[model samples]
Target: MTRSESPDLSVRQRLHPSSPFFNAARHLKKLILPAIVVFLVAQAASWERWLFLFVVPSILYEIYRFFTVRFHFATGEMVVRDGWLFNNERHIPFERIQNIDFTQTLLQRWCGVAEVRLQTASGQEPEAVLRVLAVPVVEEMRRRVFEFGEQAGAEVPPDLTTGWESREREFEVEDDGSPSPAPVSDRLLLHLPPAALMKLGLIKNRGLGLVLAGMGLAWEFDLWERFDFVEKVRPWFSDATWQRIVLLVAGTVLAGFACLLLFSLVWTFFRLYDFRLTRHGDDFRLQCGMTTRLSATVPLHRIQFVSVQETVLHRAMGAVSLQVETAGGKSEGEENASMSRRWFAPLVTPGQLTDLVAEIRPGLSLEGLDWQGLDAVGRRRLRRRALFLALLLSAGLALLFRPWGGLAIAILVPYALLHSAREGMFLAFSHFAGGIAYRSGAFTRRTSVTFHDKSQVISLHESPFDRRYAMASLHVDTAGAGTAGHRIQIPYLSRGVAKSLGEELATQAEQAAFRWS
Candidate 1:
């Protein structure tokens, strides 16, 4: 049934054939308990009979809303007409729709329906949310919406050169429901060797610290406890000489350290056990979830950029963490949007990481990888700047503390210089080939890769210090992931490279303006 011939005249236009009041009343029953309690309280705490007049009007206003609200969804726009005495209508074009999120609460699940939220770039209260139909209907609506978008030049067809048609057609079924399929490749994108898995487990996760602390608390409650090795050994050396006592103490300390290392190893392995990644057509499939099963198929081109991060410890261990950025992929609030979810590789060899990237993105190729090696001149300059800054900071600290000033300054300089030099070397180490690679760290080292297509906005700037160094920082913004926005800061690059790269990125984006699905 088409929308034009519908007899639901009260609704000038409707996305679906149901009345908004029908949906609202179905949901309004949920408020009955609270509403009844409020009414009883109002009756008992009444100051005057006039107060009852206000309550009566408030009740009528809610009742009026129960029957008056109307919403409509068209191919190109979604419109909502609401309110009582004052009427307001909101129309959102499909092109402006950032995402269509469908959520089913426990109650909504029982009723076999879900809520469809239309989020756009426009900042508004309540957003454009609608109570909608079943999951299949939502999927169908999404597909139809995409078809409508194609008409308005909002989406580009996938490149046929990539053999996407055969892959896409595999999932296709005609209106009559005949089978159309393609051969599934058994080739894997990643294979985790047992040694790699063991190394991955030894890495520290911020969450693991909390988990271990919780376990220790539980041990105090008799849920578990460490073996009392010290108590057992003390009796054995109760009457021993001073030399024997010292030897026993040293052995106990060594044993305790071993136990701690063993525990950490066990914890890491279990968290990352049997980790695997596979590619199915243009989608990257990740199947992992320890307590809860998780399976997500991320569209390849949808990835905004890729980030490889490491800490001081990780760098020494020869491992880097990789994060794939995408738009509107987070399920949490704005604060956690920048973080990774269901995507982590505790330890991967550099060669393995390169292979993974090549498999996932054909255009992402890093050739002549030797630029990651810093020259002697660059290293010396970095160390010098670090040492000079450290001395200046120590002098400032000496001025603040007088009595122990010498001792304080003595300890601060070396510590700061070492930390600064390490960080300086980390940032200066970068390589660019298929795309641009910039590795950065002070505490946590990270290498971010920005592809030609994914680079949306590129800007350059030079501080006074940068001007003296004959360098500038290039800021590259992509389409997805992170809280603030898609950005990568590459510092100390030549001014020419920064400006030229920015111009090239802008041109590529313009050429591929409508290339997203």
Candidate 2:
């Protein structure tokens, strides 16, 4: 059991002295790179060599930060005092803190220190960053924060808390040959072994991305001419026969694909080695990576929604990826994809889906929820859109191939209608138990859900097409929705029903307490 009383909050703490070294290392390029123009002028004017020290300003600033910054806890919150000339003090409430992440780069690990990031709602970056702290101290800070939060009616059950620490754990190691720095709770939900990681690499085949990276690397090193890459390939166009050219191109493409796949596998192995997800009281903690270790905690109450993704390959392997959105941090854009993907339990099977879902939001499940499918108007609209696409394709082909291409419409219309029928059949949504769910796509399926407690805005949107068809789209937006992945929007509802549903959702949201509460 955790103490309701604060844990030694009286004493102020300073960051580890090694913070400057890490700071300097981060800006090593700026610190070490000489200004060619400045040096030339200095030499011409016969100025003293000490002027060069200006380039090391970043390193010196880091040294200044080492002496100036201090932090401590007070009045159910954490306070940080930083700088002298630009003295800044921030007071962050423990309850408002949505996520906590710890990062240990290779250098930080060697020095037995980790960087801690405290994130609040709405901002794109962490609210407070503690540069470098000893492993034990960092763990203690995390423990106190969660313990205090749990006491403040965060609704983490006492029974659940008891279950975590009492369970067994898989082995974890540290640079000092001690246990993992976090002193993690023992309710390990998922662990990714090498075999499973290999499957993930193949499933998310980012081989095409390798082509761009290869081009960039070649340009960076100016290796094209030295390798005679262009000259070597000229014969494929100028000297080779048509059959020989086709064979060469096919062979080269196949070889390149294989090479890229192999590279992706190796890269995935390094990036996601020793992945583990554990429960720490009401929070889920994910720890992974090889060269640069990462530990992130998402409180159960902070989760705005959960999404399940199953591409064609995922179905073939009987696997599905689960992602959750919290208050801030990775709620949008590229950072959203990069940060959220790391949380996916790479090897999760179909049978494991329900259990995992329940673990995050107790009693929540994708199965057994009453799903509503597209209505007659919705299906007709979808078919109309498909027909429009068919007409465009037929017209483009007709322009290219005259009368023969005009015959393409006969085949295109039937195929388009059939595909649209399938699309309409699959589009579904359900609202129940103070929560909303939406499912979209035919081939690559995506399902997302959010509860009223976390719901921010309920919008009834109508486009020109929607108006023409007497239909509307009901969008349920949440606090931490990321682009594309966090889709709670249910489209193609009859306008009247859409209006009613939107009103009900808005009323429910108004009555509900804030998620953090």
Candidate 3:
């Protein structure tokens, strides 16, 4: 279908009769059945059965209202009409849609239905959704909306601003009306690479071990019982000598925890095996599951950041988790020690990851990210700051843990020195036509690249110590995540370079146009 050629077309021009009223009613059957069951159960439990009289009319009226509502889906716009007595309608013009998301829930899967959500430009409730359509119908609707959105130059707002739609058309009937470009053949995209799969299973999460441990422990003992201090100690030590026994037991417990960390590390490795990543055009797909498989696709433009991470163990093994962040929601703040999203390779050979990054963003030349003379002043500043932090940590530990804490604090000295030096020596920045990229990390190195025109904001930061070092940090923010969030920060960079880069990016950001498609 094509968009209306006439410039004078109004919002109503795009309206079309919805599939069928029965389609909505039939699809809503599952939801309605549960509500009816709850209502009947409550009525049966009522004191005098009088409550049934009130509930029956209310439920019937609601059901009737929903059944009678008329919904419209068109290439250029979408409108829903509903009312019992006073009619009400909601509309979203094609040009105003910032995003169009199609999702399929488990229930929708059984019903062969999909949900289409539309986001608008107002920054408020950007879009509304119409759910429960047949898969084929949903695909057609998505294709048409996207085509129109492209024509209108409508901006598709990100669902989560991780950075990442259009109207209907009218055309002569073809022999068969089918959604253009059939869904990518599942067979073409479904190969299971053994190596990728192995990596995925080994590194997915440590919870697998925790679950096995919990189940084994539960099966072996009466886990529900809480041990009293004396009852617990009596098995190993006489109650009269419990104090001495308590000290010895504490030492063993500490040792056991240390050993568990080591074991957990090993267990985590073997579990995440056979990880694989494949690309189908703009869509990057990942499938890796041990007992049950997980399949996910991320559109290229939807990716907000690409992160490479290595733990202390990963560093020793020359391995890293290549993570790509998309417009998915913000982290729930839980401790997910492993990669959040799909990884390219959990056991990446050193130097190969840079090649992977270049492959992901072909336009950016990561290999050209020069660190040769990126201001030695900043490096000295970082070293001095590290020394000061080490001293402060030592003092704090001494105060908090007294004698024992003081010994713990001593550990910070080597860590601080090593991290500080690594941070200074490894840091690099590259300015390209598409974006500005920064790379730095000690244990788990990360390189974050933000396009100037695509960036929403540029911020500069400096601490008291940075002032002495004549150094500054620069951050670039994008739309969606808002201020202070989803920022790209370069720590301890030359003041001149930071200011110049920030100003350049800020200017481009101001000039770029905003879209809601």
Candidate 4:
């Protein structure tokens, strides 16, 4: 039904009774460490005892918050009101809502509750968050917000009921007959198998660096002495023989590596447990996570670009990852930069990648596209640049270490030359029916596809180095472009070619319809 014809949403609703406990738990979790420190200080010094007095009131305040918070559906907007001392209210229009995500932790799942987050294009934080609601209530809210576009300007559907009676009747048989199962619009596009997850764990060792940094900090703080770790290892050093020292160092390194490997495996598995990508009409839905379940949706129209990425090991295994860039912004306090943009496929074979892409974006194909390489002049410029950088590095090393560093140039020069040659050969770009693709990267290959319709800006750039060589770069900008500031970059192109390409991209962007929802 159209929004105008839909019933008014002035009927207020309150969260489940368990919400107060969950809110208190979250607050306690954040303050636990500080509380422990304060308690220890209080025990040692009487003056610090007053700090513990705040804990009881904090818990009571959270319980009070539950009574004040209220939400309701109002015309074309969702209204939320809360706060006892400092009154606050928020009105979020259905049209401005970009994504509605639901997340539930293990405890919440057991309690049959979920947290619903409403995201807008503001790029600051979620417009509204309904924390600790019944599972059925969460589902009803998501259905209304996400499906609002399809039913806009139409009468509300008869089955779109949020009343308690309707929710109870959902699982009961109808009087006429057992109703057929609701038509399933969401189709599974990809699922990461256990074997693929293991492979990903092995190839992506992101946490190892963090572990090493932690060890360094521990050593700096004299943790080894406090923990008697140095005393345990001193026996081996007492021998002071080359063989003993070598074996001791090697064993320690291998043990640390093994621990890191196991940590990565378990961490990856838990983070991506039961990963599933599904296509729901013109939108995409991603559901995953073990301890904390997360469900996110991406409208097809909001996708600005698609990236097919492969690491050195991933390429060798014939597997790739698919990520889409959307106009959605990151939620507040989200530390993982990559988490804001959901992955379409974390691990997929080439064949699976092709099928998944085709299903999501019809008429776009990555296979058999005609690729054009950089001109000889551009290639020469890249090689020269690489060589100059290598020379500078070699000079610095020689100045710092004298004779020993002088020998390092023998290794660096040839390695630099080989890298330059490889980059020159691999740098290329191609145009497809729907979008333009740029292929680059020496060791880890990445191909980014940006649709003409989503293109926001096209420009030509030149630095002093490029000016000397009469070379320029063409860049295409779109919504949600990464730190690189461009979705597609073809560097070291001739001045004329760069300008022509920029003009063509600008024309296409202007002529194409703008549908960035």
Candidate 5:
């Protein structure tokens, strides 16, 4: 049979529908806050008799939305139609499509459905989402969307439907699935084990966040006055037993820290459960999460930069985290925090990191490069800046708190010297075959690799201090590197070196292939 004669062809042409229950749940989720407000207003105003006016309309609207929502492909574009009163429609062309991500909540997995998000280079939220579709349908859509090489008259494989049905049967056969053979082209890159995930949690700086959250909650509930720990403990301890008091305070602090660490471990386990990275064709796919499963696809050519991050703890353990910057930036704030901008390989050894980078970008290597350090003048400038800032901070503190704050100068001076030394030791830069790498940070070292050709702008910057020292900084900008604007910053280089490097990068960028989409 020709492609049009195949049953799968009919499926492809047909307008795909979303799950009714999924629509209901989504509508309910949206109305929850409004419903609460309405309930409260009705109670206060003694308008309980009119509650049905709100409830009935909401239910009816959700039912209408469930039936009206539909999507179909037409004329090389995907058309999505939804909304009741508004009648919203979005037509997205195939070429505008950048990435297609799939996600499944625990409930959706149980129902054998998934949510597909279509991302474009618009730097906004997803262009479109197939909210709820059967697993087979989702897979088929993905194949059709990504496999642009297939001809318009191309026939669907005869076994395509059968293969999907077989997969479904296997899923139904067991709680997880039958042990199946791996795909021919798919290669596993890295899988974070339970121990490694735990380490990631331990190394993460969650203590400050937790402390801030606790303080906010205490203030909100006015709990500080109700059970003040210092007040309560002070009454129980004898003023004369100074050593005992010191020991008690230290024990309490240790216990609190232990609790925070335990919380971090549990949080990390759930956040990054069963993390796995795999490569297929020109794309790298990452799958992770516990309650909510996330699948993100990153095309090799679209990756603007790759970063290898190592906190002090991670370095001590010989481990690092890998992240990549793609063309489209994620939305701002915590709402989109879980979105796909930061695809993480939680904990990988240094050797494994090198292998992973090479796998993602064949010519790119993370090791054995000759790194260049800052000049002596630049190092001295940094030290001077650190000392100046420390003195300013000490002065402000002393003015605010008198005697106790004056002691801060003693602590700040040494801390500033140590920090400056660490920065000088840590900062370095190097040029690779197709890209340049900038390494920075003291406690948490970060190495960012960006292609010279993909750079949107290359410029040399010099402050008054840098000018006096005959030094300059080179900045390279790219679209995907988030709010920082500059993707690569090689600070503290000689003026001549900076100018030459900038010119070289500009020339390379002009000659390199530019493909954002």
Candidate 6:
């Protein structure tokens, strides 16, 4: 049933009957260890078998929730009433609903249902998550939400994405002197083929998590003992010939490194397979994943911050990753959310960065802006600070190891000086008519941009050391910028400049951002 017309929305509707099962399944991961604990304890005491009593209620609670939860699309708001006993009723305004996305696991896809997630700028979690809904119902909900949004005069940002300069896209104007929304083309922004994904897997180096998983599996299944890893390898080190020893050692190291790279590649593929990003007016849709397909739409206006991230490896490969921090998408710390945002455009070439950034936020450019760097005093301060840290480290090591500890000074001092010198070149900040941008990191460069219209708070931060050197950090804070995995923070500016910039941005934000509410 489409179930999406005006009359269908006016009355309260229960989630699909399968919702209770999906809700139960969502909690299964949390219950795994506890089930194991109960089962093991049952072997000792028959009374412990009753612990399933605890497990039963936890599993069946969602059944109660299924019976209780009721949602209605009301005038200008979606009202969700849940938990008959505790009784929570939420009226989420339509305009504030930033995204209405769908996620379908393999099982859900099989069941012909999907989880419906509604999000706002309030927090990391989705404002409302309907455990499971029929595919048609979910589609209807999404359509109605956006339809109501447009009816309320929510204008889609024109040319906010790519193809802006070459094209002028307007609403389909009606003969009655009213503009109606048109079906905009889903302009393909970027798509990752397998070759590029493999390259990204190499550059991203996500093998650590895989390595840890391998170790856990080995521990769990007693694979270490099964293979006799230690005892088998001991003979190569103990009694093998010098040439044989070298060969075995080389072989072992190569095998381990190869496994690590392979794991990284596999992990990247699982997470980023068939990655496609498309833009339809202000909304940018990201679809990815090999097994569990996800379709997420991020509106342009909700985007609070944007960042270009590059590691040393990425730079060497002449590539970078583009990340967008929407007003609220997902928590930065969450693996799933982090992955989606992190790989927003996992592999971007220098040529793509400018056009891509311009699409995300019009008038924001990476090229030929009046960039300012940390001057000589700031450089000296960073060097001196590094040298001081090195000295303390050397002194501590010398006290501990006596003679060999002084060798640390030789290694650390030069490294510190080199690092400071590199920062002098790479670390810079620019404040222009469009927005404020910061370029930081000597080895792992990051360039972040936030427009004045997006800036929420402007402040200057100074430590005692900063005060001593007359240096401070100016931060242009926006809503959810912290969780977006980037910030518009320009460090090591002269105190005067920091204050001036802070005041300037604050004034600009007040004038531009105040209209939003």
Window of ten residues with lowest summed lDDT in model 2: 161-170
Each model's TM-score? Answer: 0.54, 0.79, 0.58, 0.82, 0.80, 0.81
Give the winner by lDDT. 2
Clashing residue pairs for model 5: none
- Candidate 6 clash pair list: none
Q: Please give, for residues 208-266, the per-residue lDDT of candidate 3 as tens digits.
A: 56657655654444333322445775667754476878788899877765555555454
Over 410-505, each residue of candidate 6 has an lDDT whose tens digit, in order, gives 999998888878877888888999679888777888888888888877888999988888889988877767654557777788888998888998
Please report how far candidate 3 places residue 169 from its true position, in Å: 29
* Candidate 1 residue lDDT tens string, 187-270: 356645657665655565334565575566555433332335557666878899989888878988788666666676665555
Shift of residue 36 alpha carbon in model 2, Å = 19
Worst 10 residues of 6 by lDDT: 159-168
Deviation (Å) of 68 in candidate 6 = 2.3
Query: Candidate 1 has what TM-score?
Result: 0.54
List lDDT for all candidates, in order. 0.54, 0.75, 0.52, 0.73, 0.70, 0.74
Per-residue CA lDDT of model 4 for 416-504, tens digit only, reads: 88887887787889876677889787667788888889988788899999998888888888776762222588898889888887788
**Backbone clash total, candidate 1:** 2
- How many Å off is the CA of 96 in candidate 2? 1.4
Predicted structure 6, TM vs. truth? 0.81
Candidate 5, poorest ten consecutive residues by summed lDDT:
1-10
Q: List the residue pairs that clash in candidate 1.
A: 15-73, 310-445
Q: List runs of model 3 lying over 4 Å from the truth.
A: 1-72, 77-194, 204-306, 310-360, 372-375, 480-486, 507-517
Worst ten-residue run, lDDT, model 3?
Answer: 161-170
